[model samples]
Target: MPNQSQIFNRVVSDQEVWDFNVFADGIYLITIQAKAKNWRQNFKRLFSDDDLAVQVDDYLFTELSGKKREFKGPGTWNGNELKNSSKSVIILLPLKAGAHKLRFWVDEAPMLENISVEEMNPDIKEKLVLSLSHDASAIDFIYKNIEIENLEVKYNDNTHSQKSIETKTDTDTIMITIKRPQDKKVESVIVQFKSTIEMNYKIGRIKLYQDIILSSSVNLRSQPDDESKILESLADGEQINILEEVVIGKFIAGKSYVWHKVGAHGKIGYVLSSFVEIQGQEREKIIELIKFWAQKLNIESSYVLALAGCESRYKVYATGGPASDDRLGRGIFQLTNQLKIDLNDDSKPFYSPISDLFNANQNVAAGVSYFKWLNTTKYKKSTESFKKSVVAYNAGTGNVPVVGKLNLKNYEQQTQNLVSCVLENSQKKKWGNIWWPILLFVIGFFLAAHGFVTKLNYASAQNDITIDAISNFEPDRSIRISSATSSVDGMVYFLANTSFDCGAQNCHSVLFQLDTKSGQIRKIMDDVFGAAVDLFPSPDGRYLALVALVHGGVCNSGVYYDIIDIQSLTNLAISGYHSGRYTAEYVGDNKWQNNNAFSFSLTQVNCTGTQRGTRKGEYVYNMDEAKLLMRMEQFGPENNG
Candidate 1:
């Protein structure tokens, strides 16, 4: 057996063996803290050739009573740092009263800082203590081994006595409440209890009730325990109402950590008190404003919420971010002065006051509007693309490599991780909070009592639409339909993936037309240029406009467009990139002036190979003459004012 000092507070190398003696049979928490053995000093290593940075693994192998077990440690590259990071792993295992051996080794060894084991359920008695707020009207003291008859209450002042106490007991524990006087100020109270075998005293503190603000963005869990389901993530400086005062939770370094039950985002959840600071009012209004703008922009409220959580933590006066020109990041979404000017151009549909960067509503609107612009023009309309756009929002569109798979830098990856973390809490549980499950179960019970009538209605609402005699329509394979639209005359136009046979490179999905009346589906065209993003059908049922991504190289011109004459099955494919490196008509907002003509806005972008000097203006497409005409020229960059 190894010395007790060697079992903890010392480095344990790979393949090294250490033995410890457990005096009691109980669940024990085994903790291991380590850092990367060899950290990379070069920043260029962040963008490695393999697209993934090197990572180290941490796994511990243990043998107790001839039974072996493997425990996975929390060891991975920190998204925010280019260098190696420190990580801790805690595992609770049931250990018998005997000697146990643990062998630590992995492919890439990390520098072990410390390793220790503590019994979670010890045989010793617990001294109960309650951390309450001064505003608390009453608090309960429940003891398992103590009898109510043998309990006494002592207060620092004349706040309460035996006559003012309430007692109740079941088979296990006796609960007693010491009600505070309405006018008197109480500093602290002590509850003395005598069990069948021993006597102990519980010290309770009554401090002033203060507002709390999150110091950093963290998950709001459904329960006080770490293993509980996350309700949602709250941002830094966000406000919450403490439903219950703090209680002693996790213990570390001879000090107890407190977990507070708080109410936020219309739900009650538990948050560690250490993650929150004392000062900030409940800001439900700001949340409602974010939801409103998100709905107006046809974006996910959760995504926008995550963005704000990452940017400014919903703080109206929050500042400090990457500087652009002379301006730094400001307000909810951290929009710089220059970015505000660019996003608030008159050509854009949405508008906010250029000077009101500090206003909460205006700030959120501008940020969300900018995101919408990026979604439509710069990035693909998928969640992955949205993630890219988020990184673009922070770093810049030019920094993000829009090719095969995303291989972002450490900082960019961290931004994506933060947004993903916040989004997980919002999306994982649709109904939100702990009560939703109980509410759903109750509703399910009632529906079951009422028979399958309600179930049949639900099934009917969820029924799939089937078409008869559809050409080249394979029902077997899993094909994702990217976009769908319908004309006024009930004609359905859709874009879906073909059967792995696109003639053009980078084209995956194809255009399809469904005749609802005749029950027929027609394959309109093949090769829709990568994933079909959006479909817009003309009101008179004559034409369908399409948008799709081009996924070859970085300079392969990101997104392309097409216009198809539904009656003639003729397509006008608009190549996103011209051979001369000049961009071809990047058209958007194609509104039909009549059945024969439509109007669209031309967004000019930079060219590379040849300098044709791209044009920006509102243009008209006349179907009768099959000619494109410029209606009005837009102001150049020189006249941005």
Candidate 2:
């Protein structure tokens, strides 16, 4: 190879040789101009497929670095006139400071116009393989270690006489952009570029092609700047065709120094280089981001992933779901405007504007935030709390009839599907090994059978207790059992509704006691009104508490309780007490403090007869003394249930 600069013009019959020397260690460009063997070959190649014509038919060969490399000569037809066609081929070779020999030959007798070699920077090379977008009206040939002032471009288009070509130079690369004519279509163009650092390089043909969006949601802006007017937000992995690179674009220091004009969503806009990348590369990134936020929010990554999969299939710009009305649900969890407002406020960390949900990081952060709140706060007391919370996250807490039963409805199908998907995904993640589930199942089968036997024994004991409790009364078949609970001691307390109204507001029930060891039962109280929803026994089993509703209107009506001294077999009615301006009180959320004192939340409603607002407080009641010891008002309103 000629290392510096050399030119040979002659007709080659067979083999040829040239001797040259290099003065510096660098890269060099070798340019060759030759013709096809005959006129018939040139005419046949001009009408055939470009790749088959250019790559399959090799007209010349060169021996460089002790190896022979084949090259195709130019196959363009000069005109309708049949004649041998001449073409140019360029190659880049690295050479050290030493003497070198260049050898070349032809497959058939062809005319060799000239062969020239010139010095180039070490980084400059030929990009033989190129791919462009389908809507691309321009192409960029990037060369390193070169300046815009030293590079020039010339292209020949069959359909157009003139085309716009621009040159740009950055810190690393010199870019030559060739713009095609818009009015008329050109299938391919012959591109040639001459640089001061090297001889002329020629590209056979340039064909147009498509790429995808890399970021979750890339903002297509009117201007290539951080604060420019947004044209459209492109979704993750969305297919787009690049049209051109903007000349007057602002370069972001750490992100991107280039901005491309892209066609997508039936519109054209400029996008930063950082936001676009190769296709099929964004999914892993999105999944990793979800895991990152899930860890930060202390939520199971599998559950978050399942939720994202169900809600938006992990699409960051996803919007619209069951919770969405006119405002539209957004992000992975499909958080709606109302839900966001309910769970967050205008504060740092907690503040997630709807617009920010389009970003993957912000979207996952807000979704996981709501997810945690749903599990730990809103539906915290529901059965299968996590599963129910997932349902509530989509369908709202009102759809859930009560906290005790899941009772998810078909109308909330999205919630049901999400819950099922989450449960399945969670099981898969937790039990990675199949044998673990099989072993657990085998263990659970025996435990369930044992539980069934225990339940049968308890039912038989309850039946005996029921017979003894009714033995004192006259024969009556209508005394139905309502609720029952066993204390730490051998006493089984149960409520038997005797009135026709049964568990209704004004209905009454008889409290019965059964001593399992003694095989005897006694009536504790005969006037237990309203259905006893639940029973709470003291830690030592000395006193028992009952939660029951009192008869009254919605505003005046509230939950009351009855405290019973099991040892004395006496019941004390703990009715709603008027504290301050509150008219009625509802008691719930009971927690036993010790053997004598227990605390419960009391929601005082109908204050000053307005029947509008309710205030709640945690009241400590001493069951042994049958008195209220202290009460502390809580901050937020508590549901009566």
Quick one: how many clashes does candidate 1 have? 1
The prediction achieving the highest lDDT against the true structure is 2
TM-score per model over all chains: 0.28, 0.27
Off by over 4 Å in 2: 1-239, 242-281, 321-325, 343-354, 430-641
Candidate 2, residue 397: the lDDT equals: 66
- The residue-by-residue lDDT of candidate 1 on 439-539, one tens digit each, is 11111111111111111111112233332122343444434343244443645565555322233353366666644344345567776665566676676
Candidate 1 Cα outliers beyond 4 Å, as residue runs: 1-478, 498-504, 516-519, 558-561, 572-585, 607-614, 633-641
RMSD of each: 23.8, 28.7
Location of the lowest summed lDDT over 10 successive residues in candidate 2:
203-212
Model 1 Cα RMSD, 1 decimal? 23.8
10 residues in a row with least lDDT, candidate 1: 49-58
